[model samples]
Target: MSTFPTSLTCTSLSFAWPDGTAVFDDLQVAFGPGRTGLVGVNGSGKSTLLKLIAGELTPADGTVRVAVEVGYLPQNVTLDTALRVDEALGVAATRAALHAIEAGDATEEHFDVVGDDWDVEERTLATLGELGLGHIDLDRTVGEVSGGESVLLRLAALLLRRPDALLLDEPTNNLDLYARRRLYAAVEAWSGIMVVVSHDRELLDLVDQIADLHDGRITTYGGNFTAYEEALAVAQEAAERMVRVAESDVRRQKRELIESQTKQARTDRKGRQLAASGSHGKALMDAMRRRAEETAGRNKHLHEGRLDDARRRLSEAEETVRVDEEIRIDLPSTAVPYGRIVLTVEDLEIAYGTGASRALTIGGPERIALTGRNGAGKTTLLRTIAGDLPPVAGRAEVHVPMRFLPQRLDVLDDTLTVAENVARFAPRATNNVIRARLARFLFKGARADQRADTLSGGERFRASLAALMLADPAPQLLLLDEPTNNLDMASVRQLTAALASYEGALIVVSHDMPFLESLGITRRLHLEGGELKEIDREAVGYPS
Candidate 1:
């Protein structure tokens, strides 16, 4: 903890995109003295809120107040590749002053620059080691390390500063299993205020509380991810119960209205018959008929009012119930025989970011997970296997049809509609067929007409996945690279559901352990230092 209690408060914060899309309006929220895991669906302005609090974006209205110094690690961290490790840590000036003093140069300027902290170098090295960057040297350039290492290097810099508050947005995104554990440990060790926006389940489990951002408001839930989930489940159950009760009330109202109207109609018929037969005096009969009509009108109006009130209540109750739609994927055509050879690599020397290479041979409906340091070239190997890139030395041949979903999701044509993009892949399929399939992917009717470029991150992912899976030649071998990188928990669940229906061989390059476990990965392959090796469950942080 710091000398002062850390706090962040936002007052009547309002913000909008340049295109005039309002994200938050009159939002008031605060965070104080603890770890908060911020979570929300895609397009709910979770990232925007972080940016506003970090002062990266100016709010259209209102103010953000921080009680102390802060350090922020963005979702997509970019370090100057040419910068030295010490320089990136913001300690080069102090280190230089210390070195000067060590050389017996008794200068007042050096003393002032060094201040009272002379263990800066050792502290920097220690921070780096804690984050699994022990092999990295102080004078090493950022370019010499992998992308995952860059994220850690940036985090290490922040940790060394010892700011009163730390904000991390998706900090564990590209990290491998080993790196993710290191990050989790760091998160556990944090003693001051920290706010994290991430979809990684393990990282979220370490937070002291869960802050749910929805509809431009923040709802704080006490405890970690599991506790938040339990609370949410209870809330959902209550909401669902309300909906059921409302539905029953509406049914009862309709039934009562119909029954009352039927009884009134029968009484009016009998009274009219009596009047027509002249069973009473004309004035008496007329008065009786008038009374009957008035009574019937009153009953009808009362019943109608009761029915309307019931309907209004039902509508209000329904509005309170949340609806989370799921996708339905059934791709029987993509299935391969149990004994079929999906792919073969004979001495395949694929580039692994370094001068060396890796090789592999996979068959049947195998579910493989590729894990390693970020720049160990998992994406390169996937692309090479997908035939997007040529091999460095040997051959990687796919015995069955294959489709690759890259990190960029570039398989889609932004200019075309979702239906049209799927049509492009399956030219023989009719519009109706494509649409029916797209509906399973949750692009129904007008949504299928939406252009690929206009899709949200989750929507784009689903669209891309649909096109690849629903191609003319159904893919028997599917390659997915970081499929859940930026997806929300809902979208991740959607992906899991879709994969459940896929009967083909799967090769996924992801650092997400929960997701990988959900996929029932048959073999875990760790790609590192130009070698491909199979690892056990414990090696991937999930032990059976």
Candidate 2:
């Protein structure tokens, strides 16, 4: 095996926006050889931390230490316009050559200075071949390639350079199951330090360690996500047990206090009655008074102590309650009836241009998920159903009310405000009702009036959903295409929850495995060659 570098480390590393709103603080973690998974809710700074480690961004506080060279794959990448696959790889190879020359292994004069650099061409082609793209059309423009292919091309470029450590952010987002498996196998075989930022829980099992980021802090676990989740469950249960014990203690203390107060009242009453009878009664009253005072003093002291202890116990219970709150989930209401069949595709055929046969087809009130490679006709099938594109062959039918929320959310006018978008969809809804609905979706007050273009990806998703929900009868069948693409963890969870309970039939095309799982998807339509086939849930694994 090749000698590996020491692990990557961070010391008191912190980051925040320029405005000083803290996102993370006093964080420390060490990652070494073997696969390490970075897991966290959205907006927990997972992506930001990865960027900092890759030196793509500077930390606001402390330091990021790299024990060896690092190879980074960003979560989102835009390949240069009009560049051919081979040409793009050529550029990557040239940079690698420069790095070699800078290290004193080669001289610039040894090769031709300008275009068509022979050594760089050879090196780039070899790297591309290793990535299973050796037979691809080298001259094909990147603009014509699918998103998944673009991601692979970027990785191929990085692989050509061969850094010792790798930092991948959502590396499987754009990939299909086949490509994902291939990448997972490759990473498992590599003997180097790797830190992967991913939401796919199934992917987490491939890791040797797991780190969970929540509320600006990180907790490291010795096992993968499944183990971490099991540990978390155990901890939550233990905390709840402790809370119950403390609550019981408080109730017992209160009961004791009440009994002691009652006994004191009786002693005082008896002493008063004895004093009312004179002489012998007076003597009795004096003794009774002394005894009552002694009892009262003891009771007061004991009750005070118990109160103090109870307060302390209550404080501890509050902490446990806070931990429980971290796991809460919120899904929106699609609030509609089973209604009638919304979409029907009979002999529906989808293909790329004239590339052979149909990718998929279905009919009835089917809650189908179309999944395949980037170039495969997943989205095409959805578009054909949504009327965005004409089906290449076969027939399609639409019945009940329907709405389309494309990944880009093109349904809303960019120049319009959130309220305007909602109003447009529900023409009968009053202005006040429109605003109220937007607020429920988290676009409140002034945010509801902001231009569609100004909203963040999550905000836009919610806005789009609000508009869809406002449809008088509600969309009986909803078509979503990669709806969770750029959403933060919180938003993804919220969206997933809403979809899980949505009453209408849904036909979704997504690459997000975790999102699909959260929605309780039990079946999938695996599109390949030119047909639709049902696959068991276990047969198609998605990241958690």
Candidate 3:
């Protein structure tokens, strides 16, 4: 490892929206050399903060200082379609210059540029090869590759630069289980300071620290996600208890003040009686009565001040606890009676040529997880079940109301408002009902009126799920393709919690093993070379 000054500092940094609504204010933190896992729910400004660190977006207030060069791998990127893998790594002009210099016919300018560093190109190629793409054609255009491969290609290029720090955002989202494991190994071997924003618990366990973001604030922990969660749970419960005690104290103080007022009123009535009786007696009684009233008033004010102080402290505690607490909504699925043989696939074959092998077969609620390397037919088999794409030659039938959430959230209408998309997809529900359901999903008030395209990745995912779940006739079968790709940790937890209680059949095509295991997956279907094999949990990542 190189002796690099890797540090990031932010002081009094604030950011707000166009309407002057602050997302965060006076936030300060210093990130040193370590693997950090960033956690937050939807609309919590996790992604926005990452963007600030990457220098893609500037803070509205204060400043951020970084002393080292940073290499950022964005969650989604646009690549030039015509560029080949090798040329894209160094750009076309750089490759051309290098080639000329290698031919020994270069001017002083070219010689100076390529002097002694021409071999860096070989190192770049070696890095790509280490990422398990050694056999890939370097001259192949990026457009011809799968989206997963394209993502890996960009990461390979970024890693070859070998900057002082690395920022990866959801890098393992769309890969299969094998590829995800491979990525985990790659990250483990990385020697630079790294900050990763992801929902994968398994990945978070490898981090040196975990930073949780909520309500525009950040809290740092020294351990993994599991430790952070445990601490948060305990802290939330303690705060709740403290709040209850504070409320009780306020009520007690109010009662005492009321009793003291009643006593003072009785004393004044007696003094008035004495005043009506005589002259000298009236003067003495007036002095006593005034003293009593003054004393009571002072006591009342003191008690009121004490009550206010208690309330302020309690509110602060509540605010601290709110950051750790989650708002859970129970989505009640309609009771769809399980029919005999809801889905059946026999001798399913997905191959490019006529003489290809079989891929998959199913008969019931198997809770299948399609696993393989990057070019495998995991998505193709799921599409065949959804009837969007036909199998090469196989009998696949799904009888229930099957709902599919594709790799991209294409089910949502971009131009329509969130409420409008819900109404369009779930037409049987009335406007009021649809809005109420959306509100439960945290898309209430002005947010429901925002266009779907304007929402963040987490919000869009929640809206799509709301539409599907709120439909009058809920689907009995769910087919998800990389469903947790862009969701933050909290949102993923919310989903996993809801789906755990779901009585419907789920067929998930995801590399997230922890998520699948949490759902109590009964079997795993491994696909490779157009062949499907049913395996136990041990082969996937766990064992009975």
lDDT of 1 by residue, 60-138 (tens): 9999997788899987788899998889988989998999999999899999998877899889888988998999888
Candidate with top lDDT is 1
Ordered list by TM-score, greatest first: 1, 3, 2
Clashing pairs in 3: none
Ranking by lDDT: 1, 3, 2
Model 2, CA-based lDDT: 0.71
Instruction: Give the poorly placed runs of model 2, Cα more than 4 Å off.
Output: 1-8, 17-22, 56-62, 65-68, 90-130, 275-298, 321-341, 344-364, 387-399, 407-467, 470-473, 483-500, 510-544
Runs of candidate 3 exceeding 4 Å displacement: 1-22, 25-32, 58-67, 77-82, 91-115, 143-146, 222-245, 265-280, 323-333, 346-366, 537-544
lDDT of 3 by residue, 280-303 (tens): 565677687778778877977887
The C-alpha lDDT values of all candidates are 0.85, 0.71, 0.74
How many residue pairs clash in all the candidates, one count each? 0, 6, 0
Deviation in Å, model 1, residue 114 alpha carbon: 3.3
Model 3 vs truth, CA RMSD: 3.9
Model 3 worst lDDT window (10 residues): 352-361
lDDT of 2 by residue, 1-544 (tens): 2254446888899887543546668988777787889877544677788888899878888888887888888877679859977666556445455556657766654333423554565676676665656656667788777777777888877776567888888777667766677677766766777888876666778888888777777778888878988987887788888888888888888888888889889878877766776645666667878888988999978986997798698778767653412112233344444434455566666656523233333333457676777767667767777888887777667776778888557788988888998888789889987777667676668768778865544456678878887767677678888877656555677677667667667888887766776776645876666566667767647321
Q: How many clashing residue pairs are found in candidate 2?
A: 6
The candidate that wins on TM-score is 1
Off by over 4 Å in 1: 1-6, 104-112, 328-332, 338-340, 352-359, 373-377, 387-390, 408-460, 463-467, 470-474, 535-544
- Model 1 superposed RMSD (Cα): 3.6
